[model samples]
Target: MSSRTYPAWFHRVRSLVQDRKARGQAFRYNDDELPTRPQDYDEDLSERPNDSGDSDQSSILSDISGNASSEKARYYAMKEQRNERKKQLRDRRTGQGSNQSDDEWSEETEVQKELEIEEEEIRPIKEALTEAQQSPEENSAPLKKLGGRLFRLWSTDHVKYCTFETAPKRYIEFYDPKEFRGFKTYPDGKIDGHIYMVSDDMCEIDNFTPPKNPSLNFVRLDGNGVCHCFEVQFFDNHHLTLKMPKDLVFHRQAISPPSEAPEVFTYYGICEKYSDKLYRAKQRKEAQGK
Candidate 1:
């Protein structure tokens, strides 16, 4: 068969189409081996400054990450140290085995231990001193023994003189040894009308204060039938005396006691004006203008 001749334009168009088809088939079949699009020089020039900026950002991020990791490690290490210290303290307090070193017990702790030991040592001494410091008034009475019924007060056999600095009175007891009827003159110049018996040997008086000597309580009935109380004490069994209250004061004596009778005035005491016969006598004399 004879081939027909195409026009030059048609042959050109056909050749162009066939070339395009071949190129498309080559691109589809061999996509992996295809040449990359050529880079634009202008675009590369424009992105050059961004590359440097990205590098700087990456370096800063790496540095921050490294610092954060280091800080985290330090924090965990400090936490472990704190926990160990707490465990040591708990073990010591609970009497458990402790891992603490000897340096943990400081000088202040040693001083505190020494002070505690000293206090314990002195405790008995402090108690003894406290007992010794108590007042003498709390002690028991002394042994008072006068050969059974040594002497008596206000007996007619004995002449007694009151040498109190305030009052110089005299007393004589009118006693009937058989009848037991008797009366005695008091330091205040009043007569004691009560007929009371005094044993031979004086006994210790109790429930009274100012515990210097053996003392007793004496009750007197005056002429008015009123009872008054007096405290009586004796310097010795031979010398019967009176004991006065601490608050009572006496006048000065005109004459001192003789050397031989140094304690003769010890029986004297401050006189009560209301209970004194001499004072009443003086008052009556004044009122009567005598």
Candidate 2:
């Protein structure tokens, strides 16, 4: 045994001091002095106290979540209100609920109602019409009351002048059968008639009769409050002449198909009668059948 006894503690202390000196002399980094790895520091980090900044961030996140939830709730609430209003409007229109009422009818609805009423009354179209439907009589009392008289007007009858260039025009003047339906004139110069004359100028003529002698008749007011007159001369039952301030003549031959022919134009004629209530006139010899 050596005279000097080495204790276990003495060896440990000596080694520690030697190790420190060796590190300092060699410029070596100690394990504690070196940067710690993030993985290695994880446990220690967990043990550390929380900071105010971290708590603040957590609170902000919570606040943002709360605000988002509140906004969603408000959005849904407004959507529900809009849906309810739409339901009420729909219900009212369908008459599903008496409690719900409409503010007013739209202008289009009012106009439709008016149109329906007019169609019902005027019946411009009727179902299942037939040729056998009573034809207007030559001398119906209604026709007489309306100042209607049948007449034939001819410009020329000679075959020598039967060409359109040389031949005179012809027309059979009479009232429309529909004219017997009804008529009314308003103060505003508005008129409603089953057989209304709508031309360059509007007027309603009940009748036209020639004076005993050729003379001008009194001026009369049309539905538009416009003035009009007629001149007439009776040559005989077979012949006559007529002049109207306005062209209101409707041709008998043209009545059924109706005419695209000039309904309004200056008309003068020398006409002959086939009979008292009917007449014959020729535009061209080619139109002899009419």
Candidate 3:
């Protein structure tokens, strides 16, 4: 039997189908081989500039040969265009585009503005703290006026010493002898201690025993049985303020002892007895103002 002649297109299609079958068989038998199908092949010959002629195969071959260099140049140009398009897509996806950069700048500006506003708000507080820490001379000016006066503790609590005298280089504290009831006292009912000027605003009162009760004492003593230093907060002829190490402040007022004072009067008792008198005086003053 004689083999029949077939058209060129028919031969080409037959060859492609056979090639696909061979690849599929090889992929099945060997895991490393890849299967390729006829449809997966890119064969759009009509789009090729050299394949536009339909006269004969020789004419198509001659056209391809004549435009080989131009075709290579065109291929390279298309590849570069594709690469540029891919780079632009990547920039947009990663927030590196022009609009995204402007957004980032705006966010940074907002943060900086917020920090400036916070700093401005705290400026006054910082200045006030600086003045309070640096102006010890202003606080010490009142210390000189503390000497040669009888000052009563402003509190109503009956402490061991309710009144004190600030003598030259000495501090003399004493309680009312009659107010002790049964408690014993020294012959003079006074305890003397040396006072040393430590700094512009600080002083040390040494060689004095604090009250046995912790609450009755004005300041805590140090580990060496010495008194803790005092910070003179404010002072005048009639009033004195001292700050303790533990940040406690105590006030004292100058008082004139009465000629006929009660024999058994305590600090609290005196305040209680005179409270009504103080209230009546205030009421009278308010009425006079009206």
Candidate 4:
């Protein structure tokens, strides 16, 4: 029994020594032993750890190469994540990043428009009342006067409130002044029953007599510088000619009435009742049922 035990124990010790060599071979893989090309490793795994056929330990080298490649892949993945975060930040800066729906924005604009209309609702009625209260005196108040300028309201059987500006013969050339109101807003001024041409310039007054038409107090400017001189000319929107003075300039509702027209020796065309309705050439034609 002792002799048998001795051989068995000796065999076991030798086998242990060979197994250690196999373990050491498997662990021999280092950084340099891996196949540089994948094709080379695929061609043949020629060095298994336990094989005795000239084991080259290629599997250990392959494991080291795979670990390095895995580390590189993880780095690229982290870089991609960082780039995505940067792109998100860039999108936020431009106004392109919108969170609310378009309907909400449209509703906000509509509310702003409604508020503007509400703000202007009271103006028209106030303007109408103010005009209604403007009496003849208030409308004809003297604006500051300068030399070579005349201001006055013009009234006629055709149209009333036809305001005008006139240059008298004394100061300057016969130019039209702008401080006159037009036919629409001359307030209530009237000339009735007949036509009259009174002006400072007698020749200009005589040159404007109608064909066989009668007129009253037709003359030149007396000591007061009033020009009864007038002409019958067509105005805009008038059916017939307007009896405007040649020296007077009438704007199309442009000039304000002068303060001096009422103070002068204004000639009346001898009417039965005091007529307050002023006339324009067109309006007179309409009133005649023409």
Best by TM-score: 2
| Candidate 3 C-alpha lDDT tens digits along 110-148 | 344333433442343345434545655334332222222
1 versus 2: better lDDT goes to? 2
lDDT of 1 by residue, 1-290 (tens): 01122123223333433443342322322323221111101112222222321223233433433444533443334334333444444455677755455234443453443344334423433343344345342352542432222222221111121122110122212222233224322332122222112211112122122224333323221211322233444332223333222111111223333334322222222112212444458669988995
Give the number of the best model, judged by lDDT. Answer: 3
The models' CA-based lDDT, in order, is: 0.30, 0.31, 0.32, 0.27
Q: Which is superior by TM-score, 3 or 4?
A: 3
Error of 4 at 63 (Å): 98
The root-mean-square deviation over C-alpha atoms between each candidate and the true structure, in angstroms, is 54.0, 45.5, 40.1, 45.0
Candidate 1 CA-lDDT value: 0.30
Clashes per model (N, Cα, C within 3 A)? 2, 0, 0, 27
Give lDDT: candidate 3, residue 243: 31
Off by over 4 Å in 1: 1-169, 172-177, 180-226, 243-266, 269-290
Q: Write the per-residue lDDT of candidate 2 for residues 165-256, one digit (tens) a residue.
A: 11112333444445544563233212221121211122334343323332222223232223344444432333334444323433212232
Q: Which ten residues in a row have the lowest lDDT in candidate 4?
A: 164-173
